[model samples]
Target: MNLLNMDAENRVVLNVGGIRHETYKATLKKIPATRLSRLTEALANYDPVLNEYFFDRHPGVFAQVLNYYRTGKLHYPTDVCGPLFEEELEFWGLDANQVEPCCWMTYTQGRGKFGRVSVTRRGAHVTATYGDMPGAHRFEWVNPNS
Candidate 1:
């Protein structure tokens, strides 16, 4: 029997950033051409001490990412920033478009230690700038409604 099609006896365990998760290959194979699917295909090595496949990533965020595959719904974590969560979603080969509009606004226009930002949010439309002043370093216009 192919490992991908393994039954109850073929359960796989994943250890992501010190967090252990038990899942079946079948559940992971739900979405093809993704990191999880590839990991499933590669037949990741099992850790004797942990008894799970080791993956170095954010455990808190991975929980949300895993839910996407399981439920086909992308739910962003409130505790994580939009950019970082988006990066993780990209790594998982998931579309950022699936995220909610409110999630996008979490980092649309903001100031940080590196630079300043000016954001214009008109309803669901968003225009943003990054740097010391508006239109300084980076400029982006996004219309989530469209």
Candidate 2:
């Protein structure tokens, strides 16, 4: 095989929610025991015709997961709900504890609330609720410095 063809053979293509992401196979192998690293074992998700693996998951979140494989740092995506992100992490055999310290608070927000009064920051909306409350309250914070 030519140099370019040989190089392409070492890359992997992941189709997450119809979004295509390509990366080196060695990158996925960096994190042993993860779903990505074990892609060969999961024949059900592979598409031979397309030469890619399909995942019916959030594409935006999958970008972050792929990023974790490329870079050893895992940063929380603010656009995704905390619980949803945690679920994705679990499915990929990643530990939430590995989340960077800067994102820990946002990553854990609204987690373990169990109907207690808790505030969740999601983009422009801040949702707060009281235990067994009738209605949820939404508040937006304005930066004084800005």
Candidate 3:
């Protein structure tokens, strides 16, 4: 069989921060020149006993990274801070600019000259608080359901 056919059948296990993930080798190959695609070159991260590669990285963010490989659509994970997500993307050799437009605002949120702004949604209202200082700016608006 050709290498492409063989790679499609090959499976790879990745343990990221104690989370185990299984994916086809061909999926990783979708994005060449990436850390996941060049796993064989990183012998130090391989675990022979479990037949899996181990990475001492954030598991939550890694999920999004792996999804990008599988779907070719990168998304921002809401649970992670923007800077942290950017850092994870850099480590995985993925471009942060590839984040989907739908998530771009959430991904770039809290990154401003003033400081971080925490936003919360309640029913039809959206509330945003900027910093925790004594007279911090707080805004609340009703989001009309279209």
Candidate 3 deviant stretches above 4 angstroms:
1-9, 113-146
Which candidate number maximizes lDDT? 3
Candidate order by decreasing TM-score: 2, 3, 1
lDDT-better candidate, 1 vs 3: 3
Q: Provide the lDDT at 78 for model 2.
A: 87
Q: What is the C-alpha lDDT of each candidate?
A: 0.69, 0.82, 0.86
Q: Estimate, for each residue in 1-146, the C-alpha lDDT of model 1 and write its tens digit.
A: 77655564566788888888877777788888897877633454656565568878788888977887778776667776566776777877887777656655543432131245678877766766666543466555666557
Candidate 1 is scored at a TM of 0.61
- In terms of lDDT, model 2 sits at 0.82
Best by TM-score: 2
**RMSD score of candidate 3 (Å):** 11.4
| Tens-place lDDT digits, model 2, residues 26-53 | 9999999998898893599998888999
